[model samples]
Target: MKSLFLFFFLAVSAAIYAQSASTAIKPKPSYCNEPPEAYDSRKNASAVKPAALPKFNSKPVMEYRVQVAILRKTDPTKYPFHRSLVARYQPCEEVWIVESKQSFRNRQDAEKLRAELAKMGYGGAYITTLVGYE
Candidate 1:
């Protein structure tokens, strides 16, 4: 009976020693191949200057409209036209575009106005689209 008790005590001691030795937390191994110099977060953030953003000078767009005339150098209003006419400066083409104030939803309406403008002695008047910036 005494020998059996000694055998049980030695078995319990071995098990307790094995569990305590294996419980220690160890550092995990890294698998990443990239260098850690680019990812360091300990540097001062304010010392690094951010890149400058590009300026948005204009937002040019093209749309269908009834073009009445194209003027250069002088103002568009100096020419003979109705009060509803609007002149838009096109920087891309470097010219002033004279068009009707009333926007047409479809191409047929713009063509009708263009025909009328042609009959009004504007022989060069035609329907065309131009990109302009405001």
Candidate 2:
């Protein structure tokens, strides 16, 4: 009976040791499953062709004149008041206006208007040129 008990105890201890060993030595998955095409190097290397350049047509480029407002208003409330004053100078009330002209056209017209407005000594009145549209 003593030998039998000893044999049963050894068997149970061996089984418990195996269970703990298996838990400690867990299997991990492999990280190399992705194919080469999934990488940037392979994708870029496969497309070695250069992109096509765009073509342009020759035509008389239409230009536009723009009147820019260059004055900075220190007081926000004065914006409406300044606008009203500018409207007095421009009968059309176009505190802003655009005119279409040729690309090589002289900017004298726009500059003269800006100079005249500057002479009036408005705090927020100035002009600039811009590309015109049809």
Candidate 3:
């Protein structure tokens, strides 16, 4: 019975020693390849800087609204139709957009209005889509 207790104690001591010695925590490496960069983080220190992207001064685009219009012909200054709108500026200064009361949310409705205006003797009538800025 004494030898049996001694054997069990030795087996438990070996197991406890094996577990503590095998499971050692380690610190992660600073880089993967090449030398580290001073400006970059540890995870991306060895990464290469990409090329610069093209700078564009473009305005943000929103949902487009379809507009139907006809140029004023009677005095060129006065609206041909009482309900039609007039452009505020010339092309040299700013974009001249004359949106009439016949603006539509969809293309199909705008095309229908253009055809109706054409049949009504407004031969110069046309459809143009306008963004938020216009």
Query: Which candidate should be chosen as best, given lDDT against the real structure?
Result: 1
Q: Per-residue alpha-carbon lDDT of model 3 for 7-94, expressed as tens digits?
A: 9999999999997666433333445334656443446444677555676777744333333342322123444543444444332322
Number of clashing residue pairs in every model? 0, 5, 0
Q: What's the distance in Å from true for residue 106, model 1? A: 1.5
**Maximum-TM-score candidate:** 1
lDDT of 2 at 66: 29
Off by over 4 Å in 1: 1-63, 91-94, 129-134
Model 3 residue 131 CA deviation in Å: 2.7
The TM-score between candidate 3 and the true structure equals: 0.35
Which residue window of length 10 is worst by lDDT in model 1?
25-34
Error of 2 at 28 (Å): 47
* Overall local distance difference test of candidate 3: 0.54
Ranking by TM-score: 1, 3, 2
Using lDDT as the measure, what is the rank order of every candidate, best first?
1, 3, 2
lDDT of all predictions, in order shown?
A: 0.69, 0.44, 0.54
**Candidate 2 lowest-lDDT run of ten:** 85-94
Error of 1 at 36 (Å): 36
TM-score of each: 0.44, 0.28, 0.35
Model 1, position 64, has a per-residue lDDT of 57
